[model samples]
Target chain A: MELYDLELSGNCYKVRLLAALAGIDLTLKPVDFLAGDHKRSPVIDLNPWGELPVLVDGGTVLRDSQAILVYLASAYAGHAWWPDAPAAQGDVMQWLSVASNEIHYGPNSARLVDKFGYDLDKATTLQISERILGLIDQHLQSNEWLAMGRPTIAECAVYPYIAVAGEGGIDLTPYQNINQWMARIKALPGYISMPGVA
Target chain B: MELYDLELSGNCYKVRLLAALAGIDLTLKPVDFLAGDHKRSPVIDLNPWGELPVLVDGGTVLRDSQAILVYLASAYAGHAWWPDAPAAQGDVMQWLSVASNEIHYGPNSARLVDKFGYDLDKATTLQISERILGLIDQHLQSNEWLAMGRPTIAECAVYPYIAVAGEGGIDLTPYQNINQWMARIKALPGYISMPGVA
Candidate 1:
């Protein structure tokens, strides 16, 4: 299997982290994102979205970090990472949606503005970050993991952005529950750390 | 089962449509979105995100339209709407992420700006809408369905926003392929239509 990756992208990092945790060997093909390599041929051919973190396994090519997480969990990590029950899967799927929507627009967008010079509304991104972080903290007040009471793809999906939120000017100090959750994720077996996370 | 829904929301509509097609009984509990019902107690208690299309089934309460779609398909739709195979499920999930991210921020955001007076960048939303719609059209040129070559959750996830893109000031006339895809979805057995789709 091969993964088209960008070192700085949390989305790409999540895929790498999950693959490592699952004991899956993935040949990391680094893309020149700054040079617009992802927007051109080969990468664009692999994923029409022209997004990084495209996973190619044999004949199957998958895009989107959340989707890739689902594929990895289902194919490699087994039920421990992603459950088989409908409701249990839904529990994880809810956070995946949050990862794609709230997390992407919130901390991810804020990071893009601060670290990558993307023209986006920082105030709105910060507001979204605060709201989602607060909600996750509250949810984590009683629960250990995001869903299924175990380390599912939900944790992997939402982990990177919240862990590296400080780079986006969204402080994580106020979110104590979230802080502990991040710690628990880091303590997981075979955990791999990204540049901004630790 | 009960669905907390707002009739006009494409997200909510997708859940209802899926249930209708799957022969699952859903008692629609209409939330007064204009009255800020979704932002308040019961709705917020059900889903911290406070978004509509919350599904309550016996002991399980699920939020996010995409997540609810997964739950419904897994529990009731018999793998027709959402397959169990890893690659196929991932294929469907890729579009679900698109539905949540690109579709939400693109045509959906544009609709919010035009139809509900949301303060958003109209130009960016239009650009995103055109890009995603064009990509979908190209992908559909060779394949009948978005994924798995059948009516999967991928179609259900993306159907609403593109079908109602005109409400967002995004004209769908140029994309003949997308128009045919929309028509194909409408022609599906047991398919249901929401407002502005026809």
Candidate 2:
């Protein structure tokens, strides 16, 4: 299997982190995102979205990091990461939606502005980050993990950008539960880190 | 199953459309959005995000519309809607992410701003709409359905907001392929329409 990756992107790290945690073999094909290599032939042809963390396995090619996590966990990592039961799958899926919608527009967008110099609404990103991060912190107050009472791909989908939220100039010190959850995630076996994630 | 719904919400309609197509029984507990019922008890207690389309099935309570569709499809509607294979699941999931990220921020946000008086960046929504809508139109130009060459929950997840883009002041006349795809979806068995969907 091959993964079109970026060393600095939290989206790309989601895939790499999952592959590591699940012991899946992947030949990483790092895209030169700085030079706009993602918009060029191979990456653009593989994924029209021109996004990082595109996974190709045999004939299957997936674009979104959430979808890639679903594929890798279900195909190779067994039921531990992606469950077969409908309700359990739904439980895990709510967080994946959060990963795509809230996390992407919030902490990820904030980081895009601060670390990557993207011209986005920094104030709006901070507002969104506060709302979502607070919600996640509150949820963590009652639950051990994001879903299924165990660490699933929900962790893989949501943890990367959060682990590096400070790079976006958002403070995580007030979120005690989230801090504990991050510690738990870092302690997981085969856990890996990217440039931004500590 | 009881769905805490708001009739005018595309998110709520996604769940209703899936139920109609899959023959799942759901007792609609309508949330009075204009009266801020979604922010009050029952709805807020069910989903802390205070979002519409919260599906409560026995002990399983799912907040997001995509998660609800996955639950209803995989549990009651069978593999035709939400597949069993890992690769097929990934194929369907990519569209779900689009529905959550692009569709929600694009057409949905535009509708929220125009029809419901939300204070948002309309220009950004339109730009996002143009990009994602064009991509979807191009994809549909060659393929019949969104994924697996069949009408799955991807249709249920994505078709609602696009069907009602006009309410958001979006001009869909230029996208011939999207127009054709909308017609095909409307022609499906047990297809139901919400307000402004036609």
| Per-model CA lDDT versus the true structure | 0.91, 0.93
For residues A55-159, what per-residue lDDT tens digits would candidate 2 score against the true structure?
999999999999999999999999999898999999999999999999999999999999989988898899989999999999999999999999999999999
* lDDT of predicted model 1: 0.91
TM-score of 1: 0.98
Kindly report which residue pairs in candidate 2 clash with one another: none
Q: What is the lDDT of candidate 2?
A: 0.93
lDDT of 1 by residue, B99-124 (tens): 98989999999999999999888998
Tens digit of per-residue lDDT, candidate 1, span A84-140:
899999999999999999999999999999999999889989988988998999999
lDDT of 2 by residue, B1-198 (tens): 899988898999999998998888899998888898999998899999988989998998999999999999999987989998999999999999999999999999999899988989999999999999999998998999999999999999999999899999999999998899888888888989999976
lDDT of 2 at A184: 94
Q: Which stretches of candidate 2 lie over 4 Å from their true place?
A: none
Error of 2 at A176 (Å): 0.4
Model 2 achieves a DockQ score of 0.89
Name the candidate that leads on DockQ: 2
The CAPRI quality class of candidate 2 comes to: high
